[model samples]
Target: MVISNKSNRRHFIKKAALAVGSALLLGGSLLPASVMAELGEPEKEELKFGFIKLTDMAPLAIAYEKGYFEDEGLYVTLEAQANWKVLLDGVIDGQLDGAHMLAGQPLAATIGFGTKAHIVTPLSMDLNGNGITVSNEIWEKMKAHVPMGEDGKPVHPIKADYLKPVVEEYKKEGKPFNMGMVFPVSTHNYELRYWLAAGGIHPGYYAPAKGDITGQIDADALLSVTPPPQMPATLEAGTIYGYCVGEPWNQQAVFKGIGVPVITDYEIWKDNPEKVFGMTKEFTETYPNTTVRVVKAMLRAAKWLDENDNANRMEAVKILSKSQYVGADADVIANSMTGTFEYEKGDKREVPDFNVFFRYFATYPYYSDAVWYLSQMRRWGQIAEPKSDDWYMETAKSVYRPDIYQKAAEALIEEGTLSADEFPDFATETGFRAPQSEFIDEVTFDGTKPNEYLEKFSIGLKGEEVIK
Candidate 1:
């Protein structure tokens, strides 16, 4: 029953029409005009998408499991990648048609930060699904600096400031304050750096131009890459004292009693963008119809994930835990997926926006979101050289294709799969969000003014500064 090609589709429809005595029409002539006009037949029907085994990859899984891809005339195979680099490589090599990627991967790739490839994303996958966790030993030391609420619980939005003294103590003891993030260009890296630097603890910098991509030059806290699934294990092994990663690894820390997640990214910056659906720019250009249709299917999945106040999240958890997708325990996956995030053991709090999939137009790939990642890249020295605000805007536009997202969204709207209200108003949308000022340090970010936003940071590079 796999309708992989148009010829097979035509044959199936013809046979069904004949068997059903003209009840079904060939070429869908009897379908509504809107459905008929929905993006022409997918230029390429068979697809294989890659994703890491993280909760944010849910939209891709849902699209495959719920038949959304099939509805779009796509036959998709979802494979979980070993790590971010592998996933990115898969897409670049065409072994994978696309992938659920760290928001920075495509941008970094396009700008020649790591691998040089013109990667692009037409849809963002989710938002605010990441957390920074400290090992139990680190948490115990940090507890002294963290203020307690009247309820005797640690007051939250736990700033990196609370961790500053511990970092200093480690420094005085001649111990490097080491931590883990998933990758160099990962959102985890920047968010961890952001959180740490906000607390007056330097998380170091990357001088790629000087061959110091280690990101630990002149550091107070040394951060390294640890795969997402290994965060808890790495913490337990004492290889790293803390890490920032997406779930359910953070929750796995709580479940295993090895670590405590101190802060979710939602607290670091409210509603910050996380993963994106990335493909080679060549893939999109070669199969434009297929690209739009893939976006269409994922958009529908994102809507279903958030609709009715996450009524279907437990079901999603079940699907995600089945050993082929996220494969974490159902309880661990549900810890954040079901609108609540467990920080310390038994310290589960209501963080309804922790794992945003579709609400607030999460699926639309905004230029502003791309710019924020770029700003972080520059701030942390991944970009090496300073550029004007116009360069930032142009680079974001190159990697984030909202035009393609609009096409998919409009097609969905016309086909009655979703409503216009569910999307940004295409005509008025500037692809930039209004200025945001919700970071732990309260620095405002107007995506249009990336250089200005970078200048506001006291800890990282700004202006014409280059890592020397």
Candidate 2:
């Protein structure tokens, strides 16, 4: 009888050990001698984290399913929330310790944009795993302007200008065209707006100051925030003509035959940062070691996702396909999860970096990346007022938290869980990628020279320019 109760007995002991160890190791730096002991303390060992159903949430899924969290002395329960907002709410209200979050979530929360909190991320989840899709009706309308490849599919990086005629036709017909993005401050919002504006279509502006939340004024395609998982259903219901969203969701649209993804953000900006694992500033301060441990687990998962030329991605897709994770079919998840993306059902092409987790410094939190989002916020009037270059730099530092990230990464290196070559050389890194000139319009962006780069854009509010 006693032996039969062993499972419950062991569970209780693990919890007791975690609580006792966490109390002792809360602030102890994870030096090799200390982490062995520190690993004993979870304060609370059983955790429930939330994520929206998207492939970019793979780090958290991998960390949990692969027993990496357990290796760090953490027993996790990965729950798929209904949407990003509910998932974010769970983290803020203490229903979750942490979760897969938007890159802008920590920034927006800290800055009091949507919610008032000081959320911070030590780990960036991935890079370049999003695409803009259009309903089959819209794609058919826009098809005429797109140049064809020899095989007869529309060309790569299909400019939104091709859709301008269709939008104009809608306008002439007294109809308003609608588009969907994941969130108000999401990378999808900025990327879609950037692509549309670059193609000379007014993706519209936000006057949050006027109490009008409808981000559509003087717009051809009125863009609004729809949670990622609902994107396909919403498009199918004809609520939106198309939407920009992350993987599995957009790919779901293709599988369901509701829409077709036309262009990926990799085609928009090439290896742009996506989601991140975020925690509140208070959580970080109170559970410093725990936070580091969490980061360590996630880092290992991220590396494994990208290791040996994405050897783990197929396995990751299998894990992600479970009902508790992304909850999509394995084929839908693999459409973009394993290094290639499809457009128009059969126009699949190799995009090896589409869902990068750890490779190419993807996990590092860079001020330049923060500043780029800031620039977009200003461009679209979300900031509500003009801000100086110094303001951008300071705001970036406040949200990005590169210092915290470096500490966590170094601990992993010292623990021998990862190699030094996996990260940028801290002594020599400038936190900026070289000027990238891969846009359809041929505009170059040097992260170090943000102001200059902003000025080069014919569109967008630059320098002392204010959106009036």
**Candidate 2 residue-wise lDDT, 25-139, digit = tens:** 8864334675466444545556667788788888887776666777566667777787778878888999888888888888878877778888887778899999999999999
Whole-model Cα lDDT of every candidate shown, in order:
0.89, 0.81
- Candidate 1 clash pair list: 161-199
Model 2 residue 460 CA deviation (Å) reads 2.9
lDDT of 1 by residue, 275-356 (tens): 9999999999999999999999999999999999999999999989988888899999999999998877888899999999
Question: Candidate 1: where is the Cα deviation over 4 Å?
Answer: 1-31
Q: What is the TM-score of each candidate against the true structure?
A: 0.95, 0.90
Best by TM-score: 1
**Predicted model with the maximum lDDT:** 1
Q: What lDDT does model 2 reach?
A: 0.81
Model 2 regions more than 4 Å off: 1-31, 34-44, 464-468
- Where does the lowest 10-residue lDDT sum fall in candidate 2? 1-10
